[model samples]
Target: MARAVELATVLGSDRVDQALGLAATAGRFADDDLVSILEHIAASKPVGEIVRADEAHSVQSGTIVWQALGQQPTAARESTGD
Candidate 1:
């Protein structure tokens, strides 16, 4: 919950609004349920894109989220035995 609040603070309303607009445009999510809309957006983006976006947009929040998610290793990391 704290991480969510931090991310919300970092992203602000404008960025969120823009993302929602984009989601609506790309996935016709305007009338969809929240879960369906989120699923559509997640399906549309590659994992790397999602990770990079989180890191680039809000490093601290991203770190918190990644940690909370158990900081799973990426494919490249596993391949290289990092």
Candidate 2:
């Protein structure tokens, strides 16, 4: 759940939910695919670059408290063209 929220903070809730919902509905084969989807989302450059100061503060604070490690292998897979 914490990982999901960090992802959502970076990518936005709508996108996170959209991908997660797809994974949930796409049958058992989607488990590995789940990591792929998150990789795709994280790799995407933000379409809109606007940032409110408070939102930035919130993300940093949350990360410090949550202390979650990023799922880098998934990100690396997308970067390496898998």
Candidate 3:
């Protein structure tokens, strides 16, 4: 289609080709689907980025402590001899 050629001209064939493949796989065939997919592809940053505590925040305990959560809420509960 003429619009695909126009998009390819403006955005480059490789990007368009890749987006087209993704669109086909996702079953998106509406008129604006290409542009929508391209915009989503471009706007790749998560709408909200959550910085994990282990990433560099010194005040938060790191992930290793999280692994201990599976055992129970606390060892103190088990040690109570119930």
Candidate 4:
């Protein structure tokens, strides 16, 4: 009970309440059972995933830059006319 209160100070009351309920349901009351269940619950929650837009724009590093790598500069090409 004291340990649960300590955890609640950091992890919040709602999450601790849920963990206690799960521990009771699973009949787990060992020294490390609550901690393990709380860790599992925290791990299962996603942090975040960044998703980028695929819209067409000049700012995007498209293949046009790669194609230009093998070509001469505009001034040099103009002199060669090739």
Best by TM-score: 3
Clashes of 4: 0
Worst 10 residues of 2 by lDDT: 59-68
**Candidate 1, residue 25: how far the Cα is off, in Å:** 0.3
**lDDT-superior candidate, 1 or 2:** 2
lDDT of 4 by residue, 13-82 (tens): 9888988999999999764998998898888855365555667534567676687877788998788876
- Across 1-82, the per-residue lDDT of candidate 1 in tens digits comes to 3433453477565544545666667764443433354455446765355444454576353354556475556875688884
Question: Candidate 2 lDDT, tens digit per residue, 15-56?
Answer: 878678767786523445656777776787686878677854
lDDT of each: 0.51, 0.68, 0.79, 0.84
Q: Candidates 1 and 2: which is better by TM-score?
A: 2
lDDT at residue 80 of model 1 (Cα atoms): 84
Q: For model 1, which pairs clash?
A: none
TM-score of each: 0.25, 0.37, 0.53, 0.52
Q: Which residue pairs of candidate 4 clash?
A: none
Residue 27 CA displacement from its true place in model 4, Å: 0.7
Q: Order of candidates by TM-score, top first? A: 3, 4, 2, 1
Count of clashing pairs, candidate 1: 0
Best by lDDT: 4
Candidates arranged by lDDT, highest first: 4, 3, 2, 1
